[model samples]
Target: MSQKDSNILDLLKGNLVKGDKDFELTDEECIGFYFSAMWCPPCRGFTPKLVSFYNKVKCQGEKFEIIFMSGDFDEETFHEYYAEMPWAALKFDLSSIKDTISEKFNIIGIPNLVIVDKAGNLITTNGRGAVLKQFGETVSLTWT
Candidate 1:
């Protein structure tokens, strides 16, 4: 199991995805989540940057993903707005993590990005840097 998966397992008590109760995260993928809002100007600006960064990471064969946490509107609206982001998003059971995601991740605003290790522990708040610095020997090793 990847280190990130192990960390998230503790929080996987209920379905993280909607309509898929049997779904379980694998141990290999590093998860990224973006806390955003439809009306939040910062979120709108950062979404493109975040999406650009995410695509680069994926293209480099990095085992990482994102779960966009919508701070406004319902799941449908969230999906409609971010229909092209190259990562998975939270579906049902949003209330389960609304406060927890805010407090646990110390997220007081939108466009916040949190990077977790394979075990789901905090790796970097600078996920954009991780992808940018992937050419370095140490960083490449850490993610690979």
Candidate 2:
């Protein structure tokens, strides 16, 4: 997939961190914005499930990536929460960008997962549901 989505790229580029290294988006077919927080019990419950699904799809060689967007109250909390994720996350300092993404996606609650195609166009807002129900057995194919 080509990095044709400039807006989306701008929103995410240079702001992703995975473990101790800087992360970059690859030529993936799509990207998933996982809006969640450490304080939300529901988010805590769903995050691991999503991470498992993410890892499973990755192991299957799926060309997709998930970027965690924290809803935490502070950077420390965001960092602490993000550390458990296997995928990359938005920068803790770029809180406005996170809010922009959340508003753009019309996210009214935590544990919202939105998928966007390579062109930066939204593919689905019910990503959590899709991963859990629609494509539980073949989660990777859900993006394709």
Candidate 3:
């Protein structure tokens, strides 16, 4: 693995979650950092679409995962919003980690989807667009 990729995985330590269980990032072909908040209407609207894409990928046995970086006001709100997602999330207490990620990706807005390949090279910061265009086609062409 590249240094960048290794660093990202290290940075995410102790902050990942899947369902009610803690999970680790391992062997994903690609990763998506979804920056969003429950209070944001646009974020709420886009989340389900992302979820649909997530489900489709899972059903097809794609090696991908999305990690939510919550911008919610509190941990309770973050947990409530996270419960609705089918993907993993960064814990709310890890605000510094979230902020670092956001700044690293130049995320200035909610609902921004930044995707990285297995090697941790950024595939696209406009994952929302990729998700909208050609669904399965996008996965094969752009993500892997």
Candidate 4:
């Protein structure tokens, strides 16, 4: 496997998760990340919309979920402020690989969405559209 592929092998293998540190993606659970912050206006603007979408999917019994990565803040504030989020979020404590995500994904600003499947493969290059499309698709499939 290439270096990148090898690095992501675990995420691909369903190792990354929320709530339960031991819980993995199990052929279900659509994992996504909102690369934003509580400080940025656009990030704030998009948050509620994202939350609404999440609530809808959750209500419909979809197996997908999202997380928040505070691209530019400490973990304490991240958790304290966004405690009401419908989805799981990365712990605010770890900041080591923060840039790794930005560099690899080329995230330039706030409100960027990064989504990976159960196997850690990205769903689309277009983050915004992929988030909407995938979450919507999951909801639709689950409800009907």
Candidate 5:
């Protein structure tokens, strides 16, 4: 892997939380980095749809994962927002790492979803549109 890929792996391997417990990504082939915030109106509208999509894909046994990258202003709001998500998140304390990830992905707006593969290859930066269009299985098949 290139140095940038190595850095991405290292950043992802750090602390992650799912619900109230610690969690880790294993053999998932497709990973979605969801850039969102609790305070953003668009993010608020999209989060539930993403949650439903996440559950649907997982129920169908898709080898996909999502990491919630919060743009929330504080820990309390972050946790409040994260609690509603079923997928894993970069730990609330790792705000700097979250910022680095946002910069790496060139996330310019709320409610963006950047899809990547296991080897840190870009799948699609317009993941939000894919999800919005409900291209769950069809799009997921391309990731692997």
Candidate 6:
């Protein structure tokens, strides 16, 4: 495998939670790394919007997936926040991995969505903007 694929595998090695079940990454054309927290008011507001967007694209059978990277202070908060999301999340116990990902992406704030291609190449760091400004099909076209 390439270095980028190796890095992605290391980062996403652990269990990913989606609702009550564990989720595995597959042949998604795009992956979104979503950084946010329950304590952040902006995150609280944006989460619902993102959920809607996710559902819309998913219903359309788009090969897209989002992996939440919680910034919550506790596991309980992380669970609470994650319950409202429809996508998978890095386990709360994997804070070190999350930190590494945050640093790699230069994440400076909550509610940030960084999009990457299947090979782990960056598609856009301004994914939140793309979601907000474009429809699901438009966003997919831009990313892919």
Q: Choose the strongest candidate by lDDT.
A: 3
Instruction: Return whichever of 1 and 6 wins on TM-score.
Output: 6
- Per residue, candidate 3 scores C-alpha lDDT tens digits across 1-144 of 643344565778778989888988888998999999999999998898888888888888888999999999999999899988999998779888787777778999988999987766788899988887746453432642
Reference-based TM-score of each model: 0.70, 0.89, 0.89, 0.70, 0.88, 0.89
Compute the lDDT for candidate 3. 0.84
Clashing pairs in 3: none
The lDDT of each candidate is 0.61, 0.83, 0.84, 0.59, 0.83, 0.83
> What is candidate 5's lDDT per residue for 38-84, written digit by digit as tens?
99999999999888888888987998889999889899999899989
Give the per-residue lDDT digits (tens) of candidate 1, residues 19-110: 33334456546777677777788778677766776666567787776776777666666656667566665654455555565567777766
For candidate 5, list the clashing residue pairs, or say none: none
User: What local lDDT score does residue 29 receive in model 4, on the 0 to 100 scale?
Assistant: 54
Off by over 4 Å in 4: 1-29, 129-144
- Show model 3 residue runs off by greater than 4 Å: 1-6, 135-144
State residue 129's C-alpha deviation in candidate 4, in Å: 4.2
RMSD of 1: 5.9
TM-score of candidate 2 on Cα atoms, chains taken together: 0.89
| lDDT tens per residue, model 2, 41-132 | 99999988898898988898888889998889898898889889999898888888887788777999989999998777899999988877
RMSD values for the candidates in order, in angstroms, are: 5.9, 3.9, 3.4, 4.7, 2.9, 3.0
- Superposed model 5: Cα runs more than 4 Å off: 1-5, 135-144
